[model samples]
Target: MISQAITPRELDRRREQLVDLQRYLADQEREYAELRRRVQGFIDRYVATLGPLYMELDALESQLYCAMRYLHEALARNGLDTRGPDSPKATAMPQLLVLPAGAPLPPEPEGGLIQVGPPPLKTLYRRAAKRLHPDLAPDDAERGRRERKMAEVNEAYATSDRARLESLLLAAGESMVKVRGGDADAVMEWLRSTERAVQGRLRVVQAHIALLTNHQMHALGESVERAEKKGLDPLGIMANRLRAQITERRQELYIGQRLQPESSLTEAFLRQREQRLGGGLSAARAP
Candidate 1:
C-alpha cells in the first residue's frame, strides 16, 4: 500500500541492499548445483558397485528368516511355540517376503520444489556505461562519483551480476530532475515489489542449499573422500564387510537346512536367532 514518500537516500539504500541479496542468491544457487553434482556422483558410483551385492544379501536374509518361521511353526505344531498356550502366537511374527532381483529401489522422497523466479536481466551494464560514463558528468565532484560507480558496473557486468548494474542505474536516475507529470510513486512501488520477489527467491535458494548440505549423500561423500585422502579404500572395505556378512548368513542357512526341525538342537538354534533379526518384513526387501 502507498504511504509517506521515501527520501532518495532511503530508496537508494534499499535498492543497494536488494542488489547485494541478489548477488548472494546467485552464489548460493551455484554452490547448490556443485554440491548436488558431487553428491549424486558418489551415489551413482555407490549404487553401481553395491546394488547387486545388497540384493543378494537381502535374498539370503529372506530365506534364512523364512526357514526360522518354518521351524517356529513346526514347534507350534508340537506345542513347543512357547512355555504355555497363553504365549504369543506364531502369527504375531513379521512376514518376510523375497523380491525379484531385477526390481529397482525407489529414491528418497524430496520436499517441495525450489521456486526461483525470472532469470537475471542481461546487457544492462552497456546501458549503464552509456548513461553514467563520467564524461557526461558536469563537474569534477560528480565526475569522480560517476567514474567510481561506472567501475562498479563494469565489474558487475564482467561477473554477470545484473542486480548491481540495475541498482546503480536506478540510483543514478534518482539524482536527475523530475520528469513532468510522471508517476514516481507507482515506479517506486514496482521497485519495492521487485525487491520482495528477489528476497523471496533468495530465501528459497538458501533453504535448498541447507537441505543439500544435510543430506545423507553429502555425509557419505565426505567420508569416502576423507578415506581416499588417507590412502584407504572405503568402498572395498564396505564390500569386504558385506561379503563377510554374506558368508555368515550362508553358514547359518546351511546349518539350519541340515538340522531336522523336530530335533532339540534345531529348537535351541531358532530360539537364539530370534534375538538377532528385528524390524518389519518389508525392511528385508531393498536394492
Candidate 2:
C-alpha cells in the first residue's frame, strides 16, 4: 500500500522539520529565561532604592485588583453581569510576593487545589504509566525511550493537559505497533500514525513558541531593548513610572486619612472611588 520512494523522502523531511522546531523552541526558552532575569534584576535594584513604600504600594495595587475581581465575580454569581457584550474576559492578575531585601523567594505553588488535575487526565496518566513504565522495558534503548515518554506523560498530567496526554498515548501506541508489525498493511499504518503524532507535537511546540513571543511581557522587553538602542536608560524610565504611581497612591491614602474624621467609612470610600475614576478618565483623555 505504501510507495517506497515517497516514504524515505517524507520521513527525512519530517525529521528535519522536527529538529528545526526543537532547536527553535530551545532558543525561545533561553530568550524568555534571560528576559525574566533582566526584569527581576531591574525590579530588585529599583525596589531597594525606594525603601518600604514601593513594596507597600505594590501590595496595595494587588489588593485593589483582587477586590475589583471579587466584586465582579460576586455580581456575576448574583446574575448581575455588569460587563458589556464586547468587553474582553478578565485575565487573572499576577500577584508578586514582595519580601524584605534579604528574604528568600517563596516556594512554588503545589498540592491542594493547585495539584488537582482533571479526573480523566489522572486516569490517562495512570494508564500511560502502567504501559510505559521504564522498569517494564527489557532493554536499555527501550528503557530510555520509556523514560523520555514517561517524563512527557508526567508533565502533561501535572499540567492537566489533555491534548498532550492523548497525543502521547497515540505516539506510544504507534511505536508499539511499529515494533510488532511486519506486513505491508502494518507498515503503512505505522507510517501514517507516526506522521500524525509528530505533526500533533509540532503544532503544540509552534503554539508554545507563538505564545512566548507574543506575550505582553515579551513585548515590554522588546520596548526596553529599543529604548536601550537609543541610549536611553530603560530601567530609569520604568523606575520613574513606578515612582509616579507610588506618589499618587500615597497622596490618595493621605487624603483618605484626612477625610476620615469628617466622613463616614462609606463616604470616604465613595470619595476615593470618585477620585480614582476622575484620575483614570483624565489620563485616558490626555495626549
Candidate 3:
C-alpha cells in the first residue's frame, strides 16, 4: 500500500522535469531568432564585405543549427515527436512546436501531464503533524511538538501536495483557508519554487560526487579502463560524445532565459549599420 501511494508522486516529479525541458527549448529558439536578426543587419549594410561580420553571422547560424538538434534529441528522449511537418525546421529547434497551418496549438496541460494529481501520503503526514504541533497544542509540551511538526508541514507543501496544504492550515490552529479553488498565480509560484529547490539539491549531489575523489570515482574509472582493455568499440565512444553534446545543449537551454524581440527587423538593420563601421559611423566619410 505504501509503495502504491509513493509511485504516482514519483511519476508527477518526472513530468515536471519534462515540462521544464520544454520551456528550456522554447527559450533557446527565441535567443536563436534574436541572433539571426542581429546578424541580418550586418549582412544588409556590408553586403559581404565585412569579414568579421560574416564570421559572426556564421557562428549564429551554427548555434541555431545546434540548438535545433538539441531540441530534437530532447523530444526523442522524452518519447515526444520531433517531426511535425507544419514546422519542419522547428522540429529539431528549441522553443516552439510546429503545428499544421490554421491549426491552433494545444494548450499547456494543467498542473502537468505526468501523474493523476497530488500525492495522498502528503495529506496523511500533514494531518498527523498538525495534530502534534506546538502552535496548535492544547498545552505547552504540545506547542513545542507543534513547532517541530512545522518542518513536516513545510516539506509537504514543498512537494505541491494540495491536500497537505489544506490539512496544515485546517488542523487545530484555526485561521484556515480552504484551497479548493485553483489559482494560476499560486500554481506558478509553487512550480517555480519547486524547480529552484530541485535544482539546488541536484547541485549539492553533483558536488558530493565530484568530492568523492579517490573512492567511488577511481573505482569506476578503473573498471572502465579494464573494460577498454577487453576491447571497447570506437563507435561506442563516438556515440557517447554525441550524447554529451546534446546534454550540454539542453543545459544551456535551461539556464539561458530568452526574451522575445520587440522590433526584430529594425534591430537587424541597426546591427548591419553597426557592423559596417565598428559599432558607429565615422565623422569623416571618404567619397
Number of the top-ranking candidate, with lDDT as the measure: 1
Error of 2 at 162 (Å): 50
Global Cα lDDT for candidate 3: 0.44
Look at candidate 2 and tell me the lDDT of residue 58: 63
Per-candidate TM-scores read 0.57, 0.40, 0.21
C-alpha positional error of residue 237 in candidate 3 after TM-score superposition, expressed in Å? 50
User: Which candidate tops TM-score?
Assistant: 1
How well is each residue in 232-279 modelled by candidate 1, as lDDT tens digits? Answer: 989888888878988988998898877876797976676556545432
| Candidate 2: segments with Cα more than 4 A from true spot | 1-55, 61-181, 260-273, 279-287
TM-score of 3: 0.21
Note the residue pairs that clash in candidate 1.
none
- Measured with C-alpha atoms, the lDDT of residue 83 in candidate 2 is 29
Off by over 4 Å in 1: 1-4, 7-13, 82-182, 278-287
RMSD of each: 17.2, 21.4, 26.3
Model 3 spans with C-alpha error above 4 angstroms:
1-24, 27-31, 40-127, 130-132, 135-287
Going through the candidates in order, what is the number of backbone clashes in each?
0, 0, 11
Arrange candidates by lDDT, descending.
1, 2, 3
